[model samples]
Target: MKHIAKVVELVESKKDDYIALANDIWSLAEMRYAEFESAERHASAIEAAGFTVTRGVAGMPTAFMAQAGRGGPVIGFLGEYDALAGLNQESGATACRPAADAANGNGHGCGHHLLGTASHLAAVVARDYFAAHGIEATVRFYGCPAEEAAAGKTFMARAGLFDDLDVALCWHPSVANSVFMNATLANVQAYFRFHGKASHAALAPHLGRSALDAAELMNIGVNYLREHMPDQARVHFAYINSGGISTNVVPAHAETLYTIRARTSPEAIDLFERVKQIAEGAALMTGTRVEMVFDKACSNVLHNDTLDAVLDRNMHAIGGMNVTANEVAFATEIQKTINPDDLANASRHFAAALRDPRPIIPEILPYRPDVERPVTGSTDVGDVSWAAPTTQCLTACYAWGTGFHSWQMVSQGKLSLAHKGMLLAAKTLAATGIDLVGQPATLRAAREELHRKRGLKPYQCPIPGDVTPPPARAAGTPAARASQDVIA
Candidate 1:
């Protein structure tokens, strides 16, 4: 609170440069782990702000951590720099434009480019605030990579990289402006590879054991399992490999990638184990040997009442950024593109965030603190929340009702409106960090809340014991070529 004005001024001073950073990330449009240029850009900014950089944290080449200040109750500002596949589009306009000759190239459909810059600005501003005022709390900026596949944070949590942090901060680029209260599903990703001998289908069909049959049977089992599971439990799968290209051959090798999610980590783990049983049974039914490897997993967040209270205070200070009449009309047009079911969900979500007479277009979002149930979606920040008393906010970085992982998101990430929202986030987060660092009681309360929830047990990784990252299953498989076929 002491140097908040100066801190805000610092962020303002870097405002144009910050927006440029967001645009640079948007233009780069790198995919998952391949975010080399984006990583360097963010790391360089933190370095310029007088933070020491720790490159390649959590055994990831692109992932790094930057630290400033010098004491406990270390605050972390998380950033993600991954883009979605096949979402490439030029800035502005409703029409589609790929970055190059390729039709379905990488693009920032999730607005992670904004995600990285907003939180980075928060961290840098906080550091500058401390430097100007002689504060004693340490601040960390995490340059997390590959959030698209959920790879980065899980490994960071596994490596105990976040254990020392007292609190973590994260935010996503979204259509609405608000602090979400609901918890996310605990998720686990794995691949079920079925192995068997191959033979000519036309000549010695009886001698051949088709692994494809096992994979198909596994999928059917999961589908049937849906009826028996709780309404909240989610089971999803994709046939990543289905044996030979030829129809005449009895395929010897096949695989199915699977993801299982549930309301809590324990519930998610129980469900994942049950799914493994189904996989084994399917393999037995098809005379194939089953081997499974988990790709990555994330635990559900245990929300902190203390952190949320401070976040709400800050959210009220920085009032919402209003959308123009033309933007509202644009949002209406985008709303039309959504399916009725998705449109209903988005309307319900946005309506809850706004308390106006006729949906006032959500400039400053209200913070909701009392959500008991979990949302269907999952996030790696969910893992960070379990590690420390973490709070995340959603800003209006995209148009209302704009779809995630679509051309709409990629188009709007490069818009002027998104630029405004990014600046608001930078200022708010920087002030919040200064509040915690300069004053000790709030941090104490936040830490107490974390300990109270965790008790004697430590923060646990939600992924099953054997689960691995999914990138290996499709490694060197050229998903870019596959994306081309989809768009073609």
Candidate 2:
């Protein structure tokens, strides 16, 4: 409470610069694990603010950590800046207008540009508040990368980066503002490669063993298995290699990426095993060799009721965002581009929480800790939740009903509405951080809640010990060319 006013005032004073930083990241549109410039911008700002910066943490070149203040309860703020590929839309446009100047055809479709800057801004404000008040506490900003497809935080957790954190705070850009209470699905991602002998299709048809056939059979098997899988469980696949374009020859090599999801880590891993067995069956039937390469895995979110309550209080205290008439009109136009089904889904989901039917959801949604909403989506934040007493909030940044990873969300990435939401999130986060610092009991309660939920067992990382993060590739290289063909 002592520095809450200062935190809000500080965020407001530097709002324009923060917005510019977010927009710069949006323009860079760097993909997962390739956000060098974006990370540098954040690190530079942190350094300028008198924080010690640690670049390339957890063996990721794009990942970094920044800290300020002396020894005390460490409050970690998570930030992400990776963009999605092929989502390059021009900012402030209502319709789908891809930016022609985009070199990699990527965009901040998920609003990580705003997510990163807001969290970073919160960290800075909190650091300043503690220093001015002579409070003994540490504030940290973690520049997490590759959260879009790769589980960057999962690797960091495995590397014990979050182990020392007393409590971690994170936020996402969304159409509604609320503390995240729903538990997301845990998931495992792996690539299945099938290798077989090659032969001319027109001549030596009997002698050839087609790997493409094996891959197709594996997909078919998985589809059939889906019927018997749990209702909330999901299995998705994409072709990474279809052997070759020539149909006249039997394709000798084929690969497919599979993402298996379930309510928990054990369930997801179990489903992954079943899928692997199906791959083996396909390989055996087609006389091909199958190799499974584990890509990444993330655990289901662990709820910390203590932290959740604090975040909810902070959000309500911060109140709702104010949208101007022109901003509302622009949001309405953006909503028009969204699918009717998505709009309907959003309406149903927020029917009880929302106060008005405006294009922008300005009001903070009521926190519902009693309700257990099933989230089919996955986030690397899930892994962080397991490592520490982590809590996340979502602020209204995009237009209501605007789907993530879509061009519509990218169109509003640099808009005033987004900037307002970003600042709101920053203030909320800063207030919450101040509370954690001033009230030691709250941090203890949060940590105890995490321990009680976790029992005596330690946090087990979902990623395998042998697996390492994929190295960043240069543009126009063979690996980059190959990556362009594959869907993550």
In order, what lDDT does every prediction score? 0.75, 0.87
Per-residue lDDT tens digits of candidate 2, residues 93-139? 87788887776788899999999999999999998888888989999
Best by TM-score: 2
- Candidate 2: residue pairs that collide: none
lDDT of 1 by residue, 219-278 (tens): 988898889876578989888888979999999999778888887778878888888898
Runs in model 2 deviating more than 4 A are 348-356, 474-488
The C-alpha RMSD in Å for every predicted model, in order, reads 4.7, 3.0
- lDDT value, residue 204 of candidate 1: 95
- Shift of residue 272 alpha carbon in model 1, Å: 1.4
Determine which window of 10 residues in candidate 1 has minimal summed lDDT.
Answer: 479-488
Report the lDDT of model 2 for residue 220: 95
Q: Lowest lDDT 10-mer window, candidate 2?
A: 479-488
